[model samples]
Target chain A: MEKENIRYSELERLCKEFRKTILKIITEAGSGHPGGSLSVVEILTTLYYLHLNHNPKNPFDDKRDRVVLSKGHSCPALYVILAELGYFDKQELHNLRKVNSILQGHPARVYNGGDEVKFVPGIEVSTGSLGYGLSVAVGMALGFKMDNKQNLVFAICSDGEHQEGSIWEAIMFAGFKQLDNLIEIVDYNKLQQESRIDDSVSLEPLKEKYISFNWQVYEVDGHKISELDTALADAKKYKGKPKVIIAHTVKGKGVSFMENNVDWHGKAPSKELLEQALKELEGK
Target chain B: MVTVLEYKPSREGLGEALLEIADQYPQLVAIGADTANSTSLGKFAKKYPERFVNVGIAEQNAVGIAVGLSLVGKLPVVSTYAMFLAGRCWEEIRQSVCYNYSNVKLVGTHAGLTVGPDGASHQILEDIALMRVLPNMSVIVPSDANEAKVAVKKSLEKVGAVYIRLSREKLPVFTSPEEDFVIGKAKLLREGSDCGIISCGVMVYESLVAAEILEKQGINCRVINMHTVKPIDTEAIINTAKKCKCIVTCEEHQVYGGLGSAVAEVVIKNYPVPQRFVGIKDKFGESGPAEGLMLKYGLKAQHIVETVKEVIKYK
Candidate 1:
């Protein structure tokens, strides 16, 4: 019921609140990737809640579409989304990366609910080593296509991760297969963990590269819920080519000091910074 | 259990069996690199055209795609030569498939020196050792068409990542299709007391023939087929060691970390016995015909018979 356009005004509000949640969770835990997590909240919120024909009750229902988080370092956003969908208790969000907790520093395969206490549902493959998820998603799309099952596969990749060879392999492969079902969303947060992505290794002419790979490439503001939704919807409408949405997102969008700063990439917010971030996002 | 009457390349067996698997189990799929015909996965391609992936000479892509299929719950059979699947794409196998512990079957054909005329490049004698080293990998090297057929059936049930290293040459049939071919359990072909000869893949036939020769010489030797090498059937090897007090291991692979090494590792862990390895040594095999290499590299039945006598003397 939470369609993208209907929640336009509320989208910004939800994003701000989600940013607060990420910061609070990370700061309480003393370690997390706040920058990319805050940046990806709107996209994650849109995909998990609005779209994705997956059951919160029966997670392993084979027909469900898949989501592969290529940039797994930003698991703060991923785990937040998983918790939002009632994968586990919201109270359990605070126990991330602690001893014996399902949530590790990186997302791992964990069972959800009782009876079907199996598989790492919600997460297709535990891909902490970046750049591998796209190929894996492509494999999934091909499998579904083979089975004649109408399922969409959404692979979330970071702009920084474009440097990896595995991603290009997936791109070439998807293009060859002409798999219109697979969707690749680029969280184009300019900052990498070390430096700005462009400064480190310029993925310039990125659109041209994808277009050369025969992908139906689209560009959008990752945080603009309306544009993100339209891009994803339009992707589904287009036929005969795999789609890639280059979402231009600021690194750590909602928070003040964290935005556009490379230092905030993998570093969690401090106590003072967390309060400040919350105040900025959740203003009464 | 589907009955396969004719003896064909297990890759050919896959070529015939894959589409059936695809039709029967919606989860069954394949990824190949233009080697479908060579690997005998073409029948699978024709039946379920959409289900088969042709990565176009990219072995790494083929492997990566298999990993992806595993994540999405499709049991993918990667069709490639043993040389490329385990040799060229070793990193992909390590990082993607085995690292994640996916339910994938890497169908590696053209294994061992028997892939003659194609020269040493196509021959993959080291694949068994390479695959056996990886944890969570079930290494199944079927002896003949019957065993290969059984392996094809059993690999589907075997858990985690599996590597089915098949011979390129069309081998003679020995076992009945109705026989039980469990992945880790070795099959005892001949029961004898004087000495025990354990072998896998194409070499099992040689061991059996050698056992016959040993019988003529009044040396009643035992021949056991150690198909699944990674989870070496230690009980079988130890029993053979206890029964004969000496062991002669045979394989088309290197003596190190292969079927022989795997059995040796197990036997040495439990009880040390006078063991003889009839396999390729540290040197690379030269370009020759199938029979020539087997004869030249001490891989023949006569070699096994001779080794059994030597091992018996030591025992």
Candidate 2:
């Protein structure tokens, strides 16, 4: 197989593994946003495995590409990826959201116990607040541009986060500056906590909304590896404007009961549900 | 290294210093609303075109971008009008900048009633109160052009979130060009022994004027520039109280959490002294000339003199 072809399947495998890991950690923690985490697993996996130029050991590598988590509530997904990427020991995954663990309700800049690390490299900023990731992404992109580095800044926000006027302000500013090196991934999970996004606040004409703001919009099935790669490739093709990948995805992707459900927004799986989820994931 | 003649607004000093810092460090980028001209960031925008980000009238967005840049190991200087940066986008300033401990320098221009014609809506009276209350946020109010330049540079070099309140009006230079402006240290412009007058922003100059009148009246008041409100110089306040016996604080903000309250908190805790506050008396100001507003609100050198006399009577 060609190098690109070999790398593609490797990333696909990583995505599946990441999905299983996210489910395990969230089920153990007993309180997390699983649906959103599962929805963006492919985007996170692809960025970690292929797209972003980052080193697992030297997390703060000066030239490493930055990834901002705008939808911070859905951190179980990114936490799994960072662990797989070697930010910390995989053993720490089970200790997540426990008292005194570095991993808290939301991702924070806490001192990890084993590594003598104050802030892990792969984890860029401590975040959980909504409608903020894109702005930080713009800041990082502008910083790289200022330093004449060619690395791109990727941010993962949510459809609900788009309802924020601040998010649009960042979008327009990123568009106005023509920051081609910036890429934003909006996980259109269709459901926010307690309500469907359309019923809550319509983000309709979403793709056109981004296109009008001068962002190159790329819509794709966020779970499919091929679609994920193609969308990212297309975003990179545009060299003079920022790009937004509107990945249409189900809320909870893998497990049956949690799939496409708003109840899984921050509700952890029950002990019985956890056993069932682990059985299905392990069977795969 | 451009030299200036006569008086210049503190915001102009900030604009020039920022461009110099951006030139010195490639990572220093400035984000703003549509007020680049009013904030005087247009020069920085022109000089380092790649580093300037105009977020068009969105204060919340501007703060968010600054945090993102800091996470990527880049120093970001976010510029916006005082009213919006503190009043409108304060939550972003809190979460993104302070809570995250991002190395984001927030340059708040047109602070106080001195913003003048922009009216009460544009003027920010609660900024000092807001900034002083935030954790890990170093709040600075530079007294003059030289001090503004020094404070702006200091905020960029410091390793945490910082807020530098810039004045819109032109004022006489308080600090000499060669004087060092340390973070959290109070600058004593004049030394006396009856009453200690602590002030910040253009009001520092006002306090200096108040000192001269007090000296002639045998009041012998000591004036200290308490510029950095948070991590406030408690040691200096104690030192002033020990020497001067009484204290009076004057600022272009409410008497409630502005410079007065900041000083009073330190004095009451460390040294017991009679403290008089000369500021906006917990009221929203009306639209008028800046000078008229200062007099009406009792935020001037004369007000400081009267407060000093009143505190002296109590002593």
Q: Which candidate number would show the highest DockQ if scored against the true structure?
A: 2
DockQ of 1: 0.38
For every prediction, compared with the true complex, DockQ reads: 0.38, 0.57
lDDT of 1 by residue, B124-166 (tens): 8899889888866888888877677668767887768889888
For candidate 1, the share of real interface contacts preserved is 0.46
Q: Write the per-residue lDDT of candidate 1 for residues A1-284, one digit (tens) a residue.
A: 55635677666666666777788889988987888887888888778766678887777788787888878888888887787787767787898767656676776664332244445546666667777778878888887777677989998999988998767878998998898999999999888998988788999899999999999999998888888888887897899999999999999887778989988887777799888888877763
Runs with alpha carbons beyond 4 Å of true place in candidate 2? A1-17, A109-117, B1-7, B19-23
Candidate 2 lDDT, A110-218, residue by residue in tens: 4444455466446676678888778878887877777788888888999888988889988998988899999999899899888899998899999998889998889
lDDT of each: 0.82, 0.83
In CAPRI terms, where does candidate 2 land?
A: medium
- Badly placed stretches (over 4 Å) of model 1 are A1-6, A23-35, A110-117, A191-196, A199-201, A252-284, B1-10, B19-23, B67-74, B88-102, B117-121, B133-136, B157-160, B283-286, B305-314
